[model samples]
Target: RKQRKEAPDDARIRRFEDRISEGKFYLSLSSTKNDPRLMQALRGRLNESAEALGKNVAKDSELRRDVYEKMKALERSLAKAKRMQQEEECFSSKKLHASIVSTESQLRSTRKQASYLTQLAAKTIPRGLHCLALRLSTEYFALNSSRRNIRNEPPKVDDDDDRLLFHYALFSDNVLAAAVVVNSTVTHAKDPWKHVFHVVTDGLNYGSMKMWFLSNPPGRARIDVANVEDLAWLNASYSPVLRQLTSRKTIDYYYYGTHDRGARADPNAKYRNPKYLSIMNHLRFYLPEIFPELDKILFLDDDVVVQKDLTPLWSVDLNGKVVGAVETCGEKFHRFDHYLNFSNPLIAKSFDPRACGWAFGMNVFDLREWRRQNITRIYHRWQELNEERLLWKLGTLPPGLLTFWNRSFALEKSWHVLGLGYDAKTSTRDIERAAVIHYNGNAKPWLEIGIAKFRSYWTKYVDYDQRYLRDCNVT
Candidate 1:
């Protein structure tokens, strides 16, 4: 058995030796040059010879020594060839890796440039479009053309009669938004003629606002339009609160100066339009003085669209509370700190930051009770404190919140659905179910920034066919 095994091993060794000799001749022919195929073949032969010698030469000491010497020589040649090939491969790999890194760097730079251009376009394009729309609307309003009267005269109402009145102090640059509020209110009301709307606006918009209502009156609903300037009792000189609100210092404080280092401190700081802090927004505080004869009234913000009859709000017993408004404690963003600067010690101690806040858009004010509790003084005191020390940063609601803190009654959240203008994540179902939808943020539904889905809720009441709306492309 040993002889038979040795015989096969000896033959294998001889074959490998012949192959190695053939490889050596080929390699020597081009000794200075490298050939991958020639090297691979020689390496294969060396491996075969080593395996054969291990099995066959073990039985013969002399043969084993001679084969081992030949095998060592073959291995040295194979190692040299492999080392040269590896060096070439290493050089090629380095070039490939460098090329990949360079390509990646170029890609990153291109992406950043693209991102910058995209941001620039986003900011400028919308602003340009807004400016153009404003110019067209201004020209449209300038045309002094007579529109067909839908109602001959305002529906007469007895001054002493105890009828439901929806009072709205609408101070807007967009007359379309004001008209839509009236249209939506009367359209959705069960008794359109019985419902009365008291609309107040600024001096500049009075002519266009009155003209629109005269032509497109909402089914005999008593619409009264008054300019804030014409209200003889609403003099700024007489009211310190009004004077402070309209002052340049107050504007700066609310808009840019509220930050730690003012406007320069934070590049992304939020600033309100001076118009948002206007006397019109603060006018709700003086509801008792404005409508002295009226006992209770539902005050609607111009940004709101009434989907359901607000007459039911009259029966919602405020339980002797002066103001009845929807509690906003359910949302984290609606918390006290969102509006009031609690960093100040007076504000920090006065109210609970976690306490439930209320909505001002749809409120039922008990004017008689309001006067009885002297709520206006409380409101004015806070306003004065805010002016003196910057108690709260921006809105009228903060002072309203402080004044009506313990005195106000909490109404149902469904009565007023806020965040339509700002929060895009608000549930569609909740918006549809709400009796009143308020676009309380900068994105009023009349503006292009308003969410497209919510705009339909406000715009459905608009008369797109009207000559004024058509001329300005308001539709």
Candidate 2:
């Protein structure tokens, strides 16, 4: 057979087929196994083409370029496989992380729900139970007081007799009724409390206190102080009225006689009336002696309103400090002329008045420390001398400013805020940040500005017939 001068490529391919039959492909598997099988096949084809170049170099060049392109395509396929595997691993990890976060959120929500329920259960005690408890307590206090009387001595320290005696009187039927109603409303309608809300009002208008209890009832208990003396006597006595005022709620209340007397270490200021602060020289003097263990207590003037939740203020630590009253005018002296006798150290020391802002007119107090330091003498001495700075001698001045400085406790602005009296165009939005709104100054809310920003507070509780507040006609 005349083997025509066939192309060299045809001859090389025929040889390759013969070599594969003799296992040359198996040799590729051993030498280039790590490379893809496709790469091995291309390399074998290139070797065939190179041999063919001996016969035709043009064909060898074309085959080499084709082999390079095929190798690049195979490398791309391997890279894609690696990227797909990596993406799958990343996707699995993210899904696991999301599941963990969801579980944590659920746990947190469950804990808060449990806490709310626990607080709710605590305040669910019946009203009848509280009345019974108070009745029993009253009998106990009367017995103890009688026993002390029979012994020809007053109850002393470490004696439950005196302690229970005070509590029993303070937690009377009227106080309990108010306290019970207040404690019954537990949820904050909007927020929650770690501890119960405690409110103190002069029972001036059940409106302010009542609205507070209604709007923000205690998660735990309520304490009120209401005066019980004859209207005429109440208006006249200082200690009794104060005692009544403090005793309106069972939690903690204090009422002093409007015209009566309290323990007088030194009588400097003659007139001390609850209605007229000018009449009361240093009545807050008795606060510590009466309740010595309290770290702080809020003092509020009657005409105020509580608009939002007060829990934030109650929760503050006060950092073992006293919050001073407001410095309405930037005067160093309460009165300019009062600076003449700045010789008394008390006067000298206080002449540079700390400009403590208005007492938590609605304020928080550090009562235990206040009583420990014996503020009564601090206040009374100021009152004794005729030329004594009358402004310095006043009850509110000494305890409100002097004690705060001596204790070295820092001052914090209270949410317990005072309203800057009335005006024809006063904007309550200005004082919205205030916790307790005091309707201070002569521009009375109930009398003149009947529909002030917080008027609903007063109108809700004032029984026009029974309540005789001054300036009822002003509004």
RMSD of each: 9.7, 23.9
lDDT of 1 by residue, 416-475 (tens): 999988788888898989999998765667666668878889878876787655655555
Evaluate model 2: give its TM-score: 0.39
Q: What is the Cα-based TM-score of model 1?
A: 0.68
lDDT, candidate 1, residue 65?
A: 50
Best by TM-score: 1
Poorest 10 consecutive residues by lDDT, candidate 1? 260-269
Which runs in model 2 stand beyond 4 Å of their true positions?
1-220, 224-274, 277-283, 320-350, 353-356, 385-395, 406-414, 423-427, 449-475
How many Å off is the CA of 308 in candidate 1? 1.1
lDDT of 2 by residue, 204-263 (tens): 322333332333334433233332321233232333323333332211111232222333
TM of each candidate vs. truth: 0.68, 0.39
- Per-candidate clashes, comma-separated: 0, 52
Candidate 1 clashing pairs? none
* lDDT for residue 178 in candidate 2, whole number 0-100: 37
